[model samples]
Target: MLAVLAGCTGGSRDIGEGKPGSSGDAIQIFPRDGAEDVGPERRIEVSIPDGRLERVRVTRVEDARRQAVPGRISDDGLSWRPAGGAGRLALASKYSVEAVAVDAEGRRSARNTAFTTVVPDHRFIGYFKPENRSTVGTGMIVAFEFSRPIRDRAAVQKAIRVTADPAVEVVGHWFGRDRLDFRPAAYWKPGTEVTVEVGLRDVEGAPGVFGSQRRTVGFTVGRSQVSLVDAAGHTMQVRRDGELISTVPISAGAPKTPTYNGKMVVSEMHEVTRMDGRTVGFGGEYDIKDVPHAIRLTESGTFLHGNYWAPADTFGSLNTSHGCIGLRDVKGGGGSAPGGWFFDRTLIGDVVEVVNSPDRKVAPDNGLSGWNLSWQAWKAGSALR
Candidate 1:
């Protein structure tokens, strides 16, 4: 028998590293070495020292049905991106991964098949707005936009849960695309408490993006008082729970100032904003453009915001102006202005219900206020389950 240094490796002798045909040890999967409970958000990665990756094949160790072909390869060939897919690796199923690397001179280096028990967590998916751990005015949504559009959103919707320490009722609505908003149907029951838990990990979203993680977020739904404005009565009634708390008799808009009708989710709030006519589909016919210090409420130019030029009657009586929920105020969303008082107290997720106006339901895409659609209708728009 020929004497070959059995499994012996020496420094700088470097006699056998790249000698492909000499039967030197093949590359092995390093980190994922028997990695168990792998993240459902599995991002496949494999590396080779001297060889370039030719192809990767994923297969079920047992079931033939469980398999997928990864997407196109990149130019450098060092990394691969899946074509919006997970290789359908079975959940909690034993699996194997095979990677092939080739050298520039067509020298082939093979690695021993790496084995690991692929387990799935209680797959959860959620997002954080303002970038999750964020700080913004009460007007910002601590929104967790899903990585994928959620299927079974209703069932998952109920899961997003809010828990007020005081045990106030928290309801969440599924917004189109991938957003679920939790509120008390009113404003969050103020001063109570709030906790949101979305256990969507592994939960199947649209088709490709799976709910691969879970998350929790809780914010204070401060102050329960909400002011409801009636264009007909010209009375803005503030209420806590169900009782009228305060009434602001103010002008709204002239008939032409008709406020939008529907459940408006305060998508955003600005203490001051630059309002330009061209911004809201205004043409030269109505040259009065670019109103500043405006408290923009809805996306379609409607605002429970501040307007300077409009008269005070629009606050408590017939509507006027080009369809904005006007309030008695000056420049800027301040100045002890009646509009500022209401606007100041408002948060982004707060509810602004406009009634007695002829305007149609605000379009869903205009902002995050998609709850206006009936459950049946909302589901119809989904491209996937």
Candidate 2:
């Protein structure tokens, strides 16, 4: 009885050729032993020319998890193949096949073979915002920045699901090829819970590129807070749940370098950070090593930060700095300064709207400023339509 099998490989291979005078049956296996980089669409089967297949078993191991590949033998026992839906192999996985065959003379032969599926050369991952288990403001938008440019936007979009606990309708919008943002028609209600399910694993996002993420992230919406910055009036009205809380005096950008006007979300905050003019395309005009209470409003270096170098009276009376909203605060933060006071009450997803500025509205894709776009316009960006 023959116990070992070996075969030549191209896309598929035939294994275990019996000797001319041998009584044992020759067992054949597709995807011959030692096959590498096999595609998921290839067929997997075992067969013999003139004998009955007694048993056939296939197992697949992927990401350290092993599972059996369901299959069945032909009625005549001459062949065996994976069952429907199991015919497609898994990518980046190792498969092992074992088979036993009985010849007409009652001789038995066994064969074993193994192969490896393709490891995608190009893989994409999404870096999402708001984090898992975080509590954010109502204005928070679930955004994903994909590592690779996705050619099949519909496929990528379908792989992700964003749902709210209160059962609001949330839709996804594609910001070009690398970013996807999800939001409801209006701001999320306070105390709402949102869940993001990313099921992109092995999904073809582009030609020859696959996605490698399978995760579930969730966040809770805290109280609603939206601060309106009036550049012309040099004041910010802080509102909490439709009621006016406090009015903060602010110094917006100068006339020459005006702040962008739009609905912007607070994407980041820092107690104290350095601000350099050169970093934002401006010449070496000013560089503050310690700008306190910095709240990032846009990706283009627009910040609502503490202003110590400017005269204390510069706030509320004059638009002094370049393109950042300045609040009254001393160097290194702390104290009862308006900058620190507001920063303390802020959440990552809080909304900050700047009105009456000379500059154009902040782009919708800049930071998390999707609220700047109308609901119709936002929905128009969806690939699914």
lDDT of 2 by residue, 3-52 (tens): 11000101111111111223232777889777877898899989999879
The 10-residue segment with the lowest total lDDT in model 1 = 1-10
Residue pair clashes in candidate 2: none
CA lDDT for candidate 2: 0.76
Tell me the deviation in Å of residue 9 in model 2.
60
Q: What tens digits encode model 1's per-residue C-alpha lDDT throughout 1-385?
A: 0111001111111111010123223333432534655544565555555556676555443211234546555677654445665543335433445555666677443332323444333343453432222222322333445534566775566545556567644445556666765433323334544555656665565554456545665555454444577767877786655687667764454454356666665644544332323323432223211222244445454555555555555456545445555566764336577767777566555556668767666665444555566555555543333
Regions of candidate 1 where Cα sits further than 4 Å from its true position: 1-148, 151-161, 168-177, 183-188, 199-204, 211-214, 240-246, 249-257, 285-296, 312-314, 332-334, 361-385
> How high is the CA lDDT of each candidate model?
0.48, 0.76
Scored against the true structure, residue 267 in model 2 reaches a CA lDDT of 80
**How many residue-pair clashes does candidate 2 contain?**
0
